[model samples]
Target: MIAHSVDDPLYYLHNFRQVLLWVEQRYADLLDPHELAFMQAFAGLDAPAQALMVRMVMRKGELFRSDRLEYTEIGDTCSALQSLEALGWVREPEQLSLEQLFALLRKDELASGFAGLLSRPRAAKSDLLSQLQALAPAPRPLSEWFAQAPVRIVQWCLQPLCDRMRLLFFGNLYQDWSEFVLADLGLLRFEQVPFSPGSRALQQRSEVDLALALHQCAERLEQGERPGSIVQALAGWHSDNPWLARRHGRLLFALGQQCERLGEWDLALAVYAQSSHAQARIRQVRVLERSERWQQAHALAVQLAEAPANPLEVQALQRVLPRLVRKLGGPAQPRRRARPAPVIELELPREHAALGVEEAVRQHLAQAGGEVHYVENTLFNSLFGLLCWDAIFAPVPGAFFNPFQAAPQDLHDCDFQARRAAQFDACLGRLDDGTHHQAILDRYAAKQGLQSPFVFWPMLSDALLTQALACLPAAHLKHCFLRLLQDIRNNRAGMPDLIQFWPEQGLYRMVEVKGPGDRLQDNQLRWLEFCAEHGLPVAVCHVRWSEAA
Candidate 1:
């Protein structure tokens, strides 16, 4: 694991280029003549321009806010956009600034719910258009245009056709991409660095240059490319910084995983030894066993079985551990971690297309006025939170970001941790003063104008806030808040659903509604146990439908 510098935009751009170039070749025959012609023209473009096109298409697809493509920052204003327009496969309104662009979008209904932005205010005046025209004489970046306006601008770029194309061709890559981008040193947060020498140098060496190159080697090993090239390049990566080395560990793990998949046992073991990835130890044991190093594999397997650090790793290792133990003539007793006690999961059986169980629960809660909200993961993960750690971060300056995934590469960075703690403290102060309720609601309202599901959930009402505050213990708040502060991606789930708040009595209970046979998922079970431990009011309501006789 090499400790590369943090300002590595090339790392992301490398990936951006690789995916496009690979797709262009892989899907060549599938392209219509016009699409083929388009690719040819795309191929003719210089690397920077090509990367820009891919970035736009990869992010927003064929359709997006025209303003986002305008790059007046570096003589890039609308030139690349015009080239795409020349392809006739791309499109935009006559204007680039959103005042006119959104107006155009709304007039045509090009984007669903985009009209909502037309209705959002600016400085207490009517909608943002008039305010935008007044604030700046010309169209700039959407973020700048709406600098004073209260509306979400980040989601304005969307490509409908390109999105479908991705789902059609690259479905398997989606999870892998998410896994990579959602991690600490992944592409998403690392590319936010502005155009500069430092960014340019690393941007060229993106994940594709590193990880994808290794992937291609593993994939085509039989077809002739030497794994030695990859090993040589990997071994050459050197860094004294432990933080950077940890970041590179992911890259090493990716290579080891590929080697293991390709049946390169010795190479896989060598790669795994240097990696501190969660599954690295178990993976090494597998390779060692495959090589018939029975004694060494047995010793490592015994140590892992006795005390595994990663649950998923243990689950995977357990399947093979018993066999290895028997061969080694070891005792059958495995010192497994104690499992959580069972919580009976209730289910509500379907009633043949009648009112759905969820709707029925909603109606039941509504009977008493402001009793229940069907706030699932979408709401709890988004609206109810004080800080939007999911979309925003305040780590040390010069930290890069991924334009694709909405979070940073490494939330675990010591600098990020310290800054996030301070940010969280500020949010807590607002919460105590009752200011956070409205501030959070305002964030939701601002996002209402955008094209994201995160903004469209049930509104965070004042009554809900008051009732929630009454029932929520400080410890629970601290736990959840700190979890979000630390890692928004993993900690966002596991929340109880259908929180029924009684504003009259300033009380609430988390009601998990289920049909006659539905079961609790691991995350749901975790929530129930947390509630149980915390002494919070929670119930798993089960509904049984009568026969239609």
Candidate 2:
């Protein structure tokens, strides 16, 4: 489950009980009496009501309008709302006076769509207030206000608990909807996993050749005539006699994909046509259709549908051929042939240059330091690895623990936040007691099934961990975790690019390497400020523009 698509819904929901139990056991001491009662009440609710509470935590304030509660498929929300109110966990907003209602209405402009509701002339505010107040029920006494024990208890039990849970399932708690969808979940675990010699070779071939092609000839490709120099370099090769071998072919496909991304269909078609994969042919049919060569496209579609190279190709053919056949009636043409086309000059996006920046900085920083972890987030990730695991997987159901996934349950009912205070307090205690680092190392090393990204033992030397722990004390580390929980959506990046550690002298300095004219982003500024406040050693080293090229 750890290695599967991080987007898998089951991967997260299945861990519900485990996540709950893990925190309960680990952070038992942090729960005060009221908080304990609130958690017990939470556990006793019907699944839908429990899920409704979990969903409410991601939203601001405990109060939600009846309509704002989402994912209605989970269960009867009205019933859940009733259960919550009966338990004294939620409040029904007061039915107020017309004047009060009108005052609330003015919080936003009467929207264009709703202006009709207030189109007629209205009574004066003073008269309306008097009239509405007389008919309104008398205001409740202070005893009703004092009767909100459930509200008080849940706030203590759920806020920190959910925040911690949000950190586990989503390292960035306040991330907007899109960020959650597009997020690279592996960052919490591994961004740079150990690659095999073959994969490394392929990766090197892909990134370097593409970088070199764009860096060296990109300007000329954009300014020059048709057949960008990069594509022209491979112009002589064909599907049957592809002179561009494996590594070069890898680079070729990457450039074609780049052209396709930049909306250069002609260049993409020209480039992909030289590759042997059926996908290249499948892609070309669309380009042909775009160019109005229906007969040629239909022929190729038929060819592919009859004998698709892979399962993906078969699916692709099925999706395209129905429309393609309608175009086939236009003309009869030679079967099993693709149109010959020329590649055009291609432009690179701004980020294309950044591909080479890491290598450039790495080479420059290679000198002087005894060893550089380029530690960035990895160090912090490893330090908090075990706690983060508890956040997501919640390993409470002892015998049911699967090497693959957490115990499955209704996603909405995953009580992510209840034990938050205790678990985090335990993390701070373990780190201070000098047992935290070893525990992370011991568990990660012993469990072959473990895939948590925070286990930095494999990446860093033990001496480095000793130095990192010394530099990152428990209080400072806790402050950082809380900040991450608050800003994970936007603060994932902006860590200093490199750190040079001199183990021989037991010294290290966090360095932000900027390639000329680059300024620190907002998130980076926050981190730098945090470091400055804590007296941690850090520096900003801007690479001279003269050396940039």
Candidate 3:
């Protein structure tokens, strides 16, 4: 748990110190000489200096005006910054681009700074920036831009080093210093998994570099860099680490997608062929088909059909293969149809339209029978999360690295369940012995609001919990849970929109509501089929709104 508090003036400083200590202890070997030196020098700084540094590091941009750096805790910011400057951690930038200067100065300041240079001084900030940019002035120091200005813009030179420390601490660049504050404030809570000594995400220094490289590549892609160029940059990059390897695959997959969108089918095919992402092969087949390579597409589709990776793959192949065979001049195979679910045709009044189709159906159903809740995917997932909390949070090496993780590092990996097969089996054993009810209820009561990948705390109330546990049969739950374990990432969603529970009769039925002109999605269809196969009560509720009487 986070020990820092908002009441403390130096709470941010304490959080920053905690990160430095954590990375220094766990990732000492991975740290470069510069990082080590920075950590050492940072520790030697006084509290005010440290607090000021933390403030700068946590802020959005590297450049900050000295006046804006004011803090009651860090009295006399300039005096504190002197120590940072001595260490070359923070310094006045040599030059600021037009954009940087524009960002630093407000509209009035910009007007004052370049009085005669501006055509329309009173114009909006954006227009003024455009007008200034048209002049194409060379980058210069802030003193040159605003000679009479009192405040100076100091750039945090050690931002990259600080970012590296943050990456090591969090195992990702996306999560930043705010996680500490959010956790401290109880806005976000993580499960307390006992991390092993060898639980760090990146075991080697090269892996750290690889993670950063992958992040940069992703950023480049997002910035609309050419897909080919980004792919070229990643040409020889590889990682033995499963996590890093997964990141690499995802990057390639994204590049492939971008290539497809740009009408570069050949490049997309090449990228997809090289990518290890689960969806890459199917994409490759699609690209082949699109490029009029029918034979190749057919062959690949056949291979996928024979050994599909997951149910989603199987579902996709069923659609692709028949078309491919037809294109290859083979007899068109009959499309396999999804099993039919019981249907509830609802012509609800327009008066209830504002409540949405699902809610309207839920209300109509409640009038006819028992309680109805618009749970969608939450109810069963929450149940599974509660029942199998122990297995999911097991402190396996490489599973957990930091205390801030909401789920394991490898939660969506293919071998996530395989890695904890024994633990999952034991958790499932409770269902067979009828102990699942007590176990789920106990976990719900004890672990309420604590983070779990599967649990949706806001959706699971006492009434819903008690009703679900009582009404949902143990055998049916075992089947659903097993299916969830089969492919957690895909199977967790696509559940029916609402579940109707009859507490008095110990009965329940799930309803997938579809408004007018809406059809069931592939995932929803898959779930409905699964329910039908296991003899679980589920129905498709198609709603059509009617005029009020």
Where model 2 places Cα greater than 4 Å from the true spot, the runs are: 1-355, 395-419, 447-449, 453-476, 545-549
Error at 432, model 3, angstroms: 3.4
Off by over 4 Å in 1: 1-229, 240-247, 263-266, 276-354, 364-370, 383-385, 388-391, 395-405, 411-421, 424-471, 485-488, 513-518, 541-545
TM-scores for all candidates? 0.49, 0.33, 0.90
Residue 454, model 1, lDDT: 29
Whole-model Cα lDDT of every candidate shown, in order: 0.52, 0.50, 0.87
Q: What lDDT tens digits, residue by residue, belong to model 2 across residues 467-533?
A: 6654455666666665554434334356676666665565666777666467776556666766776
Judged by whole-model lDDT over C-alpha atoms, candidate 1 comes out at 0.52
Better of 1 and 3 by TM-score: 3
Candidate 3, backbone clash total: 0
Q: List clashing residue pairs in candidate 3.
A: none
| Worst-scoring 10-residue span by lDDT in model 3 | 179-188
lDDT of 2: 0.50
Q: TM-score of the candidate numbered 3?
A: 0.90
Best of the candidates, TM-score: 3
